[model samples]
Target: MQRDALSLSQYIVYRNGVPAGARGGLRNMFHRAFGAATFAGFWRHWNPIFGYVLGRYIYSPLQRVVPRPLALILTFVVCGAVHDLVTMAVRGAPAFFFVPWFVLLGTGVVLGRAVGLDLSGRPWVARAAANLAYVLACLAITLAGECFIW
Candidate 1:
């Protein structure tokens, strides 16, 4: 990715500084990219300024008390709320999409983590299957939002 001029480092999610692709190791580049589809990864990775503040002050502390799934949901909720606040300042009307989008994203991240955890300690094929399922699940969430939430 960095070599191909296609890397989105901050947009990519990391746990303990390891890239999701490095951990998943999908031989196919397409699989690798989508397999790493995560809202927290995107929100926490993109833009160092907000990323550091969010990661250090908000997200990290939340994870201490909450499980990974709950932590992910809370993270997205906070993100959604922040986006809503920012948009509301301009329009001052209830948003129909922003909050729901983050909720859907929270769902995606929780489900993806669940699938990934289930595949842990399994063989390579299981890992690959988990990765595929996770990406498909994220895709489903985004598409479903466009159809129904929009």
Candidate 2:
């Protein structure tokens, strides 16, 4: 598999069109993520820093060994596990929120791609709304699972 040669700073600039510490960087990140036309595109735009590491360190290696769909889901699971670790450390208790949350998001991306979901030609507002809705729906499901199941 080909590796991304861009350094972290370069990746951020390339993805966000601005330097990491530049004013409006956060705004740009949100605009790009929410403005994306698909759920996968949203993940692509969400956090250039985390995405870079996850892509290079986690997803790429898994992709080499597993099927793409399974790799994608496992990547999210690993990412969420890291987040949960931090949450558990900070709260001094076990945390289970992010794993299922990220799993749903990953599944959404897989299903969206399988269905050929694309909103690139739609109006920007419409695209943003759809992307936001997908994210919120995943969060809602995760919250419900946490309350009822976990």
Candidate 3:
């Protein structure tokens, strides 16, 4: 299934669900590929491996070992850092990209715990609502920070 991309910027503007930012296809592809490659490098450095051993041995069971919420938070934090680093490399504004993305990830984790996946295996509607709320809350926090800080 094709998943919709969440728009961190839109969430702040709408005070509703996350919105997708407009981007050229090529640019979006490059950004996604760069982000993926960076994160892959980080993953390899953190947990070195290769081949079927990598997927089956290293990754598969790792998720089961940790609580879902903790894992989600950690993964998003790492992803945010990867995205921030890529943005810095491409745009030369490291701190600006880094701070917002890092904060966004942290916000996502807190929101997830507070809403998304927190309900006890409820209906799909409930889960989706929670996730939507989580995204909105994160954006709100980001906007608040931007307003007060700069």
Task: Put the candidates in TM-score order, highest first.
Answer: 2, 1, 3
Q: Candidate 2: deviation at residue 149, Å?
A: 2.2
Residue clash pairs of candidate 2: none
Pick the winner on lDDT between candidates 1 and 3: 1
For each candidate, C-alpha RMSD in Å? 8.8, 1.6, 13.2
Model 2: how far is 48 from its true place, Å? Answer: 0.5
Deviation from native of the Cα of residue 142 in model 2, angstroms: 1.0
Candidate 2 lDDT score relative to the true structure:
0.91
| Model 2 poorest 10 in a row by lDDT | 1-10
Q: Summarize candidate 1's per-residue lDDT along 1-150 as a digit string, tens digits.
A: 221232435433332244445654233333433333443333333443444555555677788998867776777678778887888888988665456666776786666556654433556555556555654666576568769655
Instruction: Give me the displacement of residue 76 in model 3, in angstroms.
Output: 4.0
The global Cα lDDT (0 to 1) of model 3 is: 0.43
Expressed as tens digits, the lDDT of each residue in 1-150 for candidate 3 is 111132334322222122234344334333332232222322222211221233343334455788655554455555556666887888887444445644564545455446533343555455445545554666677677777877
Over 4 Å off, model 1:
1-44, 117-150
Question: Which lDDT values do the candidates have, in the order given?
Answer: 0.55, 0.91, 0.43
How does residue 145 of candidate 3 score in lDDT?
A: 79
Q: How many Å off is the CA of 36 in candidate 3?
A: 23
TM-scores vs. true structure, each candidate: 0.51, 0.95, 0.40
Worst 10 residues of 3 by lDDT: 42-51
